[model samples]
Target: MIAETVTAFNERWWNNFLESTNVLKKTNVFHNCMQKQETASMREDVMKIIRLIAINNIPEFGFRLYIEGKNIASKELSSFFENFTPGNDEKFEEWSERAFGDKKFGIIINRGEKFNPTLVEKIAKKITPLTEKVGIPRLGVTFTIFIGNYGWTPLGIHTDGLGENVMHFHLGKGGKTMYTWDVETYEKIVEPANRFNNTKIEEILDKANVFDFEDGDIYFMPYGEYHVGKSDELSIGLTLWFNNHTESALAKKLIDSLLFNNLEESYEILPMDTSPYYDFENFEDVKKLFHNNFGDKNFLTLLESTYRDYKMALYSNAGFWEPPFPKAEKIDHNLNFKIKIKEPFKIIYYSDSDSLLNLFIRGKKISLINNSSIIDLIKKLNSGEQLQKETVFNTLDISWNLDIKKYVLDIFFENHIIIVDYA
Candidate 1:
């Protein structure tokens, strides 16, 4: 049943919707494109995730709660969870209702993709054509989950981060209305300080672009638009953010990466010298230090190489900002098993120099000595075909050590780039 819905989304609805709307150029809504059953399934999956988060007490997952238009303090949330008991979904729902009374409340969880693999898989499949139309953003993609009966968005009417656009999937028990204003129009009416968190919604309603949608609908908004949403009844939404970085930002990231890779951590502190005068004689020594540390490559060359590495990792993960956590258990390579690449993920490889083959899988880079046999094996694995363990083993160069071959295979299994079935 899920497969049928996915097929419809990928083949028909998405294609037609894209043709009808200028996706990144304007704001648009598609209604009833998804089935209610699918939304229910998504709700169940998200509820399970919320339950797990409460059970484990994971504050780092970026959970924000608000009641009656006020943010809930972290310390209070910690105390609430400390005394709370996690049980079935119904228990959690009842507890929340009682704890917050009848007041409107909202829950926003960042990094939604990390918690729900099923949701991520469906989203990836649906967005494949979009990515084909507009290449993946250099900053990659991320998602945030919004669940609540909040009357108005906590942040009020505001623009997203620079170069960041959003696509919201509404999984609803109730309807939602979105209000948007162009930059010029909003600035003319609202004060500079009131540009964000503006509560004068009634004043701007007449001039705003209003979009009201129900369950199983999607809303896409381009970057730099001032917008906010209102949901008087309980609802859930997943917003996918396509983050595009400015050139300067991308350069800074590359520089940071280069520094991280080249510099060593030091805890030792250097005491201040008695003399206040600058030491001009040591300037050459500082230059020599950086020259030796960064190797013989020119600074520009190093930056270019870092950028390439970033691109490879981003593309390998299908533009996701972060890859799934690697599996914890050590793989048993000796056991016979059929292995296949995971769905919606592809292994990307390139040869920068003649002597080395770079393989990017699940956003990590692995380098092996360039060899035709190994290259052939990568192509076979990437073809999405299931192959016997022995066939994979035989594809490796016979001259290579057996341990080396096994180690290469283990990397794929550990990173979940490939799934193995013992049966």
Candidate 2:
């Protein structure tokens, strides 16, 4: 019976579907025959729309914004505010200020079951068809809303959190959402020391590639890609969430096992190499060593197996994993630049002087070196010799701490250089 219900539910489209007075409507109708019961199809429809947009296609039509160009019914507005109870008037004011400021506010809505049924119904009716087509069932009928003011000042460049792909639909008379993926350009304007930190949202939004939306417009953006939005007037919109929850759950589990269960041994079997061989060593061997020491199996499999244990510990007892102390890497996109560390590490290249790119390894800045010096260092150090400080530091007039210098050397040691202890 459940299968039949699902089949019938999946086959029907809510917006155009008319509950025929005939047996056809009755076929999928919800009834405890002994007791009269009725269930609407909007919930199912909402699920369908999420599915449609998730597959990298904008649905044939975007979302609808029902507006009378007048204030929403006071009673309806009051009802809508019920679930949005302010912790205090000050808290409400704070939320409103943040939401209405020139910048975009991403309101991630979860626990959808807590919302009033009528509010849910209205949004569901508008969203169901699009979500249904996307096939992202995890999105269900639940959704999120992004609030903001009119114009560019309000929304800055930023990407959604990891694992969340959103189908954004505008729902106000003049609602508009703008976005783009030119994160490199965005970085030029908004400097996020580390993009993963949530508060860096403003910086991220500033750099996003921008596209504007009119009422009924829809756009799809996968997680990890940066974007931003603005509205011409007061705007309301819906963004459905679909993420790889299962994979994420497993990843968390695997991380927990690595951190807690085998932490002592993990340090022993660290993903490290001491072999003097420069590039000849098989990276696979290093990988296998890690697998053997950390717990036998591929990374993905290890994640899956360890997740259950992690879940138990995480839920029953509050436990979390702390990332290992950071290591840093320098990233360069300026290919035309030639850098040599002679004296002051002067770099000569035709890169956008205005662009500000952050180099990170494990979420910390090591330093930004001239690209030429980086290239020459790779070449000079690749001979696999313990590089002398004079040959290394003298070539690039950079001041260095003994430890930081060693850390830099470790990067070269991995593939390009060997530490020659010429004291």
Candidate 3:
């Protein structure tokens, strides 16, 4: 029998859930998954995000607002933010109601991890254990925030992209209901062209597997399930998407990454008589081009190396598809400060060779000389211990130039791998 609900979510629970053969094949709800304090913290972070939207701090592409199921135009949104001034004590729902007047509206923010570091940290703490057990997917994970009082999902009944499953965390002053239909069942009832039809929801409502959840609850739905959400009252939720790409998709992404990293543009035009058709001799030229770009490495070797870098970076960023924005302010290396690795994230490193080490910090890679001192220092940081800036520098090899040590520290500071507390 399918286990439809769990009392809580944690590493042990996740492991047990996965052990079930029907794990991803069914919809599951986790009740009281988040503690009251944790839910309150999440609500606070979401409010800050809403305020960021009001001040235009969030990028245009990061968020979308819909009124009565119609997407608001960018210019209109800009105008709305320009005139939106909330009182210090004003709640988000209150502002949302005032902004839209009587019309029902929904707001969705993509890449929410970039906007709130605290939320990301909290989520990572809960999720890292699962990842540690099963490993992260090649394509990584991303999160979206849904906030609204809209009666139905603005997108209508839809399935996410291929190989994408979602875990929704409900943090609500209200409640939400979700309806899902398996692919085979949905296809049998809905016409091909009208599969996404929101207007016809009544016709299929009784056929769906219904789930209603309130604050501190979580709902998990597998990939390829046709689903829609209903929130008749003000509510907010965060959904994390775990993207498990098909082999072909993974190959395409790796090739794209390789090309992006190695391909250099040349302004020179090819000879007029150059043949476009491939011959054995031309194939040699192709091989030479690969060699020139990749230093005599075979194509497979190049792909393997690229995949390693991608995976390490993804893992280092705590499976976030997009890492958090870099630290905004410049670091003053000369001043004394306490530094430590950011919570729930650590520097990932592997030795490429006896002489070189590959380090990934928040999805950015940096290469360094493979020295014992440097490795030891990284280990200490990863241990979650705070260290003095001067002490960190002193821990490095004395033979190394002062400038090199400072540059290394600067990279860590800028990439947000290390949090600095000014003394």
Candidate 4:
């Protein structure tokens, strides 16, 4: 019966572990602040980097090494493990025990979502202030227990697919260690070429920050950073990753809603072969194709209004018609300069195997024709070269087959990534 519950990826928010009030402290919850004066401010500053915050004296989080007392005879702890039945929040049920070939890889006991052990709940209760103070909305809590000897984890540098996570060591002996670097540092220190070999992270560890925690220590690492951890001997720890919303997340939320109906299966893109196939002479017809589809102001105007709806939604999400924050940065009205492809977003795409069109737009897989003309169009737009209005119109026209072209145009104009004003 349990195996019947296939775990689908959860996208909605559920972080309300406890009521939110006075969540941040001018000082530590169990001891002094790491930076006494800025302890409160650090709560907010941690957002700038991927969340990696640790403070001493978290207290009673891991009084015992495992579920049983640390001093309990090893045989006794072993006996308890042998007889253990999961409570409610242990997060391990999804995997079949044989998921891995080696038994020594250890077992992850899932206690189910409703079952948070007393110690686990205590840590979460203590953390509510920090998150509440930061003003990031919390939806719910998720936690798990890891039981194994030293070097037990996959230990490769990786990022979490779910929401934000907090790791706390309940009990362990020997060197259980964690190392991490922000996504920024990761893109620099580790060459993209060697990313496949897991050792790249370890080789670059000297350049990354290291985190060491004692029993009962609490560490918060925000989502989307590269990290890995391991212990020298058998250990037990609890991890919580709850859904949290940010301004970018809010923007994404609105965009996702607007495209919900047309959202197709996501396609992962690989690096393209840059070698050319068609001569530049072939592009004249491609140019004609784009001009015929997008030469008018009507499509551009529809695109602008759709984005206005997004900005309005953004304001309402803040419970106001205009948010206190400055206007969206990408919405510049300046049309005099050449339109350049926006920097900062990594582009990925996939085409319909049968139709041969490449589709893409910020995770929305856009399909365009597979010919050299289309490839040339994509590279030109991805490039930062100044684009004239003819260039701008053709850029949108290049991905001609996607039904959601209008939404894509709306996004380009709204975000100001595809400037139509380029002369």
Task: Score each candidate by Cα lDDT.
Answer: 0.80, 0.39, 0.82, 0.41
Please provide, for model 3 over 1-423, each residue's C-alpha lDDT reduced to its tens digit, 9 standing for 90 to 100.
996655354666787666642656668887778877778678778877777677864447578889888888888877777776454567766777778777888989988887776688788878887788767877988889998888888888998888887889998878999998888999999889988745578788989999999989888888888999999988899999888979999999999999777766455554444665653455443344443749778789999999999989998989987776776677787678988998789899999689898899888888888888888889999999999988898989989898888878888888878888999
Model 1 lDDT tens row, 211-236: 99888999888899999999887788
- Candidate 4 per-residue lDDT, tens place, 1-423, comes to 564422111111112222211122111111111222332232122111111111212112221222211233445534443444332332222121322223334324332222222233234334444444444233334454555542625536776654554434344323356776777888787777654325555568787677766444445566666777665454445555555546566455555644442234444453454547854654443344333324554644534544544443322122111111211344333344455554422233344365575433322333444555445555676666656644545555565654443444445444323545534
User: What global local distance difference test value does model 3 have?
Assistant: 0.82
Cα TM-score per model? 0.86, 0.32, 0.85, 0.34
Best by lDDT: 3
**Model 2 worst lDDT run, 10 consecutive residues:** 315-324
What's the TM for model 4?
0.34
Among all candidates shown, the one with the greatest TM-score:
1
Error of 3 at 376 (Å): 1.5
Q: Summarize candidate 2's per-residue lDDT along 1-423 as a digit string, tens digits.
A: 354332222336332233431211111122121111111233223333323232323222232211222223444444434433333223322444532344332232233322323333344444444344544332122355443343432324456655665555554444464556555665555456643323345445544455665555455565665555555455445565554345556466468656554443334443566777777455654444453446555666655545543433222111111111222333122222222221111112122233432222211223344444444654554333344455665554366544554455554333111223323
Write down the lDDT that model 2 would get: 0.39
lDDT of 1: 0.80
Give the better candidate number (2 or 3) by TM-score: 3
